[model samples]
Target: MLRIITEPTEAKTELERISGRTQGGETLQQEAAVREILQAVKRVGDEALLDYTAKFDGQVLKAEQLRVSGSELDAAYHQVSREFVDAITLACRQIKAFHRQRMPKSWVQFGQDEIVLGKRYNAVDRAGLYVPGGRAAYPSTVLMNAIPAQVAQVPRIVMVTPPGEDGKVNPAVLVAAQEAGVSEIYRVGGAQAVAALAYGTKTLPKVDVITGPGNIYVTLAKKMVYGVVGIDSLAGPSEVLIIADQQAKAVHVAADLLAQAEHDPMAAAILLTTDETLAKQVKQEVEQQLRNHPRRLLTEKAIAHYGLIVVVDSLSRAAELSNLFAPEHLELEIAEPWDLLEQIRHAGAIFLGNSTPEAVGDYLAGPNHTLPTSGAARYASALGVETFMKHSSLIQYSPTALQKVSNAIETLAKAEGLHSHSESVRLRREMDNG
Candidate 1:
């Protein structure tokens, strides 16, 4: 059953416990295992990928079969329905449009004495996208990860996903990848796939950045390979924190919470409300809805362990709690949502008004759904075109500009006891003077 906390101290303690719910001691052991996998792939490349795929995924694959053929890409469209294509196409358009606005522009500004200063933004040569495969086929994840790289104009975008026992990638996932302009895909996943992308196998080229969510192993692999290549944030399980008032419908609130809980057994669904009566109603509604749920076993596990409800005295207190958690998804299902939004300081994504569920953001809402989790919203942001591109500082100084600052540069360089650093500036000034 979902627990409700009335006391502020208990609520704080419970929220902290949930935020740090990730495995503690087991993580060290897992990291050691992941390190072995990474080193194996780094050493032998494609051979290691094939060996690991067969061992972990229970599907045997040959080196030639690692990369998905062009014929398979064509066949994927036929495998999925037209409705899915149309829907994915629309999502592609929406996501592309949204990220296009987020593309960082290269700019230069002239300053006094003809000093040039700005930044130059450019896309990475190649980008690797990891799409998790197991519980469900995530076409949306393909769009969310791929479209941003596409908008950033990443050249040679490649995808990696685990194949089914039949050694076939999910049709909808392939279709979404193609729709989002990623056709170079491989039928591989897990830490080995991450290793291949990072270390560069003979079949899979090394990528500049890897983006997508996966299980603990994949997350650890990304963490390990971060210095070798750029990556999106270390994504944790999905979570939603809903602050609803009496005006919000109990059924709607319950459905929204369940939507998050259904993602995984570790997913969290929390609600903070000013109305105790409404809180009770929502709890009952959640149980009533779970009775006939298809994923009841997993969803119930999530709700029973990570789910929570807190009846606060005011909406301000609710906002305070929500900020403290820094949830991946935050919904304001209250009368004056905009008014309350001002009080919110942290959250990966915020859904305003009663109608805007996290599902909309998960699907065709245009914003990238690849958001920070596990309190990372305190310092991080959602994945976007910025993830696939990098900026270089642009600096150029005229002879006049160099002369003006040469003495100060020499003084600072001498203070640091670096003769060559001081000489470089001194020579430029002397040449101009001579």
Candidate 2:
């Protein structure tokens, strides 16, 4: 079902279209709907959350039942197998270890003139983690979002996920949350859940930052409430852009592409290679491998609409097209991956060589898998410890230091026609001089 295009111009067009897949053609309507949900939640609080949960999720819940019970979290361990618990524990340790390496420290710089300047970093008081529960319970998402907050030492990490038709949260999600140091779990989801985290209800405490990925409504809701609270990124569907060569195995490359396509019908998988033969083989392999796949219907739709293959003149050209695409996940399947890695300028996560696949990063590879999608890699980055923390500029200017720069500051402030700004500095200088 994958289409192969040799012409460079057509490849560029297809790549652009695929990279912008989350534009959501009906924007005004969707934005208005999300805005209404946010406003309703903001106005009426938990009542609105209950109403939307019942309407959208088809599961009616009361105020007291909004929070997942402590017994439920304990029973989650009993429901999952020992293997599941062990695997989740292993992933939790790996993710925590990875983020620990990225922890940033507060640093202060001293100058000869005694002008103290530094940056102080502190974790937000509370953080909200949203885990999607539509197609499947994404325990991986819980690990990815919660571990970063834990590494940042966020005081309180609260998780919100949609309950199923049975009015119960997924056992796997609860187990993963607990493993990631999050004890507070709420069973509300969709745009309304975003509202609760942003504005806070009587039962749910407001969070300083919200992280995780969801559907269109959840994405737009995050966008709407961005000013009220910080968010990881306006995450789009999963995507992968791979650059392969003649030596790259067709089966392996095809499997990696399908790995991304299986995420959603809008997910994109693109392949660029100098070898026309390899491109065609990968194309054929993708179709062959999709035969009777569990997610065939959705994967086929993704391939038919967003999948693409480009036969370039050289590996350099392939890298050029890849940088233009700015994919969320980039895999270099060339003979010398590091050699071509020099040409890479934009990508959220990079998988090197033929031995490494994007799947490793998705699981226990020790990197946050919640990466920027839909060409957002050009400006955004993967969710990490920085997402749940903020920094303030620490400044302390001694009287002598202020005197040294007072004239410059006063001149600049007066030139900008703000006397009050300069007067404050002028008074301090005059006090020390007098």
Estimate the Cα RMSD of every predicted model relative to the unseen true structure. 1.0, 1.0
With candidate 1 superimposed using the best TM-score fit, by how many Å does residue 8's alpha carbon deviate from the native? Answer: 0.8
Model 2: how far is 259 from its true place, Å?
Answer: 0.6
lDDT of each: 0.94, 0.93
Mark the regions of model 2 whose C-alpha exceeds 4 Å error after superposition: 24-26
Candidate 2, 229-273: lDDT as tens digits = 999998888999999989999999999999999999999999998
What is the overall TM-score of model 2 with all chains considered together?
Answer: 0.98
TM accuracy, model 1: 0.98
Q: TM-score for every candidate vs. truth?
A: 0.98, 0.98
Clashing pairs in 1: none
* Cα lDDT tens digits for candidate 1, 1-434: 98988999999988887888774623678999999999999999999999999998988889999989999999999998999999998988888888889888999999999999999999999999999999999999999999999888888898999998789999999999989888899999999999999999999999999999999999999999999999998888889999999999999999999999999999999999999999999999999999999999999999999999999999999999999999989999999999999999999999999989999999998998999988899999999999999999999999999999999999999999999999999988998999
